[model samples]
Target: LSVVQDQIDDLKISLNISLRIVLIGKTGSGKSSSGNAVLGWSEFKSDLSQTSVTKLCQKAQGRVEGRRVEVVDTPGLFDSTMSHHEVNEEMLKCISLLAPGPHVFLLVLQIGRFTPEEKETLNLIMKAFGKDAQKFTIILFTHGDKLEDYGLSLEEFIQKKCDDSCKKLISDCGNRCHVFNNKEKDTERKYIQVRGLIKKIDDVVRANGGGCYTNEMLQEMKRKMEEMEEKFKQEMQKMQQRMEEQRDENEKVLQERDNELKELKTNIKRERTLREEEQKNCNLFFHNITIIGPYFQKCAKMNQSFAQK
Candidate 1:
């Protein structure tokens, strides 16, 4: 019983090993289809149109071969139709979805369809994922039927047909590659390929000391966001301070205006009193003059009358 319990504990430890994978590519490079294949179901929307279908980062989780698997399907990273700003916004979403970080990045490519558009796809991937991304990346090729039809293996195709840029991309990814045929009706083959891909990822994780891929770019982004938050707080404090100062200044001006108004009212009252006093004095003088003039006139008339007598 003790041995059985120990085995159970070991199994639990193995089961707890989680694998986080992020899929990236251009529009219609079979990113969604590859994600569906990896999940062993049609959890993601896959189409063959030239336009982009997945507009955001979508995550799906399931158990694969006793290991927990989480896949994040991101929008096309190098869609020419999308502006740089739009691509950047989507890339940030992808990074956020992979939070903490991703263990592997599956760069999907369609076999026999490597065009100039695809050539620049790697540059975009590196730009988005950072320089150290190649260490944690795997080149996943879709449309395996093309290779089967041509009777050539992925190795042969890469050696004989791939351009300099494609070869360089494969070399950058440590030559790690896997092929998948979503259109294949063989369930057994699909399962085998998915298992093989997972094994490859496990080997990569082991090689990297069981640590996920992280780069200066991601760290810089986090740093910038922190700095931005601090800056915003400082700016808000400054704005509040300015507003308070303005309020104080306005209050002082209002107080000064009120004081001036009160002084003007007092001056007006004093002037009015002075005017009233002057009017009263003038009236008294006129009244005295009238009384004196009448008395003088009567005296003069009496003198003239006595002389005539």
Candidate 2:
């Protein structure tokens, strides 16, 4: 009886285990709705917008089938409005939000609406997250209602209507895929889909030897970010230092100019003093000449009158 009880306890613990999942895809790929569906609640904002709705990476937690699940919703990759840098920052943020690492990456795609952008979805994901992320990825197709409306199973749609690239994407993901009807009204049906998804997630964790995607890549990316940040800091510091040095050099040049100007003013003042003294001496000599010339003229007149007598 004790052994049976121990086995039951172990099963309960397994059922109650936690899961970390991230949803990634292009804009308008139903990532937000899919995240809400997985949580079995409307934790994420779902809407129809011409632009990407979830602009940042956000995390929410809930219990699905008695298991704790963490869902990280991210903005649309390759969004026209968002720059590549913005997307990378968000990707890093997603990595951090998942903390240690995510157990699965749900590459969400919309059924019957494959476009050119959607074709590069997987490649973009691998580029942003890393190549190894593919091993932990699961292709999640939303808008299952569309498939239901056309009376086609998910697999049937893939084989009949999906293009070669789409098929290749599925094959690359190891044929692991699931469809979600986010608008379903029946609780039991929603539960079944979510349960099936959880089962797939369990399989992935098991295949990985019960390990989540390692933090090695995340650490490497972070180290790169830190390096970039450090480099930027160094560049800014060098620029600032150069500016300060230039300012000091300019100040020194200005000081030299000021000193030269002061010396020029002093020389001008000395020259002016000398000119005044010379002018005074010339005026006095001219006055003495004027006085002596009159005296000599008077003596010459007296001598001439005496000789005539």
Best by TM-score: 2
Scored by lDDT, the top model is 2
Residue range with the least summed lDDT across 10 consecutive positions in model 2: 8-17
lDDT of 1 by residue, 1-309 (tens): 966755664454354457789998878889998998888898999889988888878899777876778889888866667786677667657656765678888989999888787777667766666566778889999998898788899899899888889998898789999988878888898899899988888767765656676545577745776798899999999999999999999999999999999999999999999999999999999999898998989999999999999
Q: Relative to the true structure, how large is the alpha-carbon lDDT of every model? A: 0.81, 0.84
Sum up the clashes in candidate 2. 0
| Cand. 2 TM to true fold | 0.66
Q: For residues 68-184, write the lDDT of model 2, one tens digit per residue.
A: 899999888788889978987897687778777888999888888888887887887776776777888999998899997888999899999899999999999999999998778
> Residue 250 error for model 2, in Å?
41
